[model samples]
Target chain A: MEDSLVLVDIGNTNIHIWEEGKIYDIKNPIAFGEDVFYISVNENKEKEFLKLNPSALNLKNVVNFDTSYIGLGIDRIMACKAVDDGLVVDAGSAVTIDIMQNKVHLGGVIMPGISSIKKAYATISPKLDIEFGELNLKKLPQNTQEAVTFGGIGAVVLMINSLKKDKKVYLTGGDGKFLSRYIDGVYVKDLVFRGMLKTIKEDLREGKK
Target chain B: MEDSLVLVDIGNTNIHIWEEGKIYDIKNPIAFGEDVFYISVNENKEKEFLKLNPSALNLKNVVNFDTSYIGLGIDRIMACKAVDDGLVVDAGSAVTIDIMQNKVHLGGVIMPGISSIKKAYATISPKLDIEFGELNLKKLPQNTQEAVTFGGIGAVVLMINSLKKDKKVYLTGGDGKFLSRYIDGVYVKDLVFRGMLKTIKEDLREGKK
Candidate 1:
């Protein structure tokens, strides 16, 4: 596993690393390791990665789903490709849901991830002094503190319930557990990485021919 | 009716006018007329309205809901106050739902409205060219065109459905017509105005005392 290629999914929020099938969060101290399969929407970070690991395969250029829309986002496409069918819900800085059936990636929705929503209101209205706390969507929110938490998380829970209607929905991301709690979904970590590994295996098979 | 006060609800997307019990959309040329009651979250716009008519009352500063949390938008509280026991879904640049029962304001959820989602993606990825045409929530979106359009509207539809479980929901705002098609809600054209009128009437009653 030490010598294995690191699958990196550079997202709007964080740099997600998949090492030996496990997901690791890496930020600030960017690591340039051995063989790397990299994909990112942020151009500046991608350039920095390229400079550090010249041999790193820019997976963004390599993987394109037949069903993915133009500018659908490389990170999202990779997550969609990981699954054979049904919905792939990636909960990064923003949550993206792409429906893939029989390898064809159908389109999905994008909404602000939980923390992003919280960060938004707090940033705009600093006078409120909304600090972090637990939330219960079942009970009526009493004050501004409860309202912000519920507003951010409740909207997303409702979104997941809407799309996951009577279908097997897969959840992956930092806040996947938080979202999955409200809805019935299978949480699979390192989905983008898993998709990258599949891509590498396919490329190797094609190269041998 | 000529001497009736003009109600202006300056929102994130549009400036809504309620005059003679009708709603008017004013886009380009800003209108100024006799006796205006204005409510807006935007401070600059509030200042401009104040300059236009020094006598105009900005309800954002004056009206405070007994049940609403601090920093809750006046537009939303006003909308909630319009309904006695139901859900108020104000569909503007952002969709906010406030729960009101027995004149007690329960908390609500806020998310990006239909057009905001569309504009956001188009702004981030200009090359996509997501010009609106038609949307079918039942059908799987074929390409980026369908994805962006459907994604924007569909998510909000689902959100409405989630919040509307067993409870009556009312739809308002610029995109209310678009959202109404997918959900079961009574479309109230000028909710902010309706609420504003209610607020002004209450104030006048209190002032008489």
Candidate 2:
């Protein structure tokens, strides 16, 4: 097994395996060298993927950062790698607001993403059915479609504001720019991937020893 | 038919009729006078109820307040009656943030109430299963259950802040008090009912003439 490490992040909708210089979905996975490891929310998927290569490692003993937060997701820890102290606001399929002060995880807020909020309304009150493109995402929303859109924006801004009191907010994920449109924060793409790199470094150092 | 008018506001979940000095749900509709008027989101329910009393009056032109807003909900109009300007935030099964500047409805934001937020996540992503009690609602939520609970709280507070720039905010609906816990706004229990009364007085003045 080579000193290189592989990181697989399993979420609700998709599985992401980081290899080489990019992140890939399961269908588009790029084969990496030996010393592969994975962290996931889906225990079943993790087990299934591990079946293919019994030598693959599971990430253990996280790293220098261990917070009091219970159920600390690896993705959050990845974002934590960016800055020791500051808040990480991930705006993707789900909006996660994590507060990390001096490398100690103080827990955070997790809520539905904008799409999740829109989907929730459509499912419950069918009358609330309306759609707006990304361009219309900004502006004073006039109708139900726009209102829901703007409300989705407002929902994210508020949650971040609630947790981000005087803390420098580090934003990541798909809708990070959309959120940054209002909130003052540093938008860092590929936060989870950064987290993967953080672990790979640890593994690399361990290899040398 | 008596000249004293009845106001019925039929919504997706329930129907409310304003008679005397009180607002009653469909379940406990007081024995109203023959003269009746209704505003509803449900056209089918409107037709069904209209069949019972042909002599009753269905409010046509809404009332004095006519903002240039498209798709203005009766519940919104009801809240509008309370304030000629500022913002009307109804924190019911859904959270609606309507901005009225100089008594003209500019537009608004509609989002999931606490229940809707919870329901949306529950329906779409079953893995997002978290529950928090009312007491847990007031605290800075620690767990996923609490994060979700606080997320719901933050969602409402943010939307309200988006439109309520330096303007007084009027809050109503079931979760008004819950929201007022964080947001500095007046929690009117029956804003829609107050709106009903505002129109009833107009009808009374027109009747004398």
Candidate 2 residues A55-167, lDDT tens each? 66655454556666666667767777667788898877778888888767777777788778777777657767666434243467777777776676666776676678899
Query: Which window of ten consecutive residues has the lowest lDDT sum in model 2 chain A?
Result: A129-138
Q: Report lDDT (CA) for all predictions.
A: 0.69, 0.70
Tens-digit per-residue lDDT, B1-209, candidate 2:
32365778777778887666567688322344576766677777776776775555544354666566677787788787778877888887788888777767777778877787877667545556656444343355566666776676666776676568898888888788878876778988778867766766675447631
Clashing pairs in 2: none
Q: Judged by DockQ cut-offs, is candidate 2 incorrect, acceptable, medium or high?
A: medium
lDDT of 1 by residue, B1-209 (tens): 44577888775445677777777866422546767778777666666667767777776555546674545778888898788788888876567777878777877766655554555555444534467547677776656666655555666666566666677888887777777877787898877777777777776436532
Which portions of model 1 miss their true places by more than 4 Å?
Answer: A1-74, A84-86, A100-107, A114-135, A140-145, A166-168, A177-183, A201-203, A206-209, B1-73, B101-104, B113-133, B166-168, B196-209
Q: What is the DockQ (computed on Cα atoms) for candidate 2?
A: 0.59
Query: Which structure among the candidates has the greatest TM-score?
Result: 2
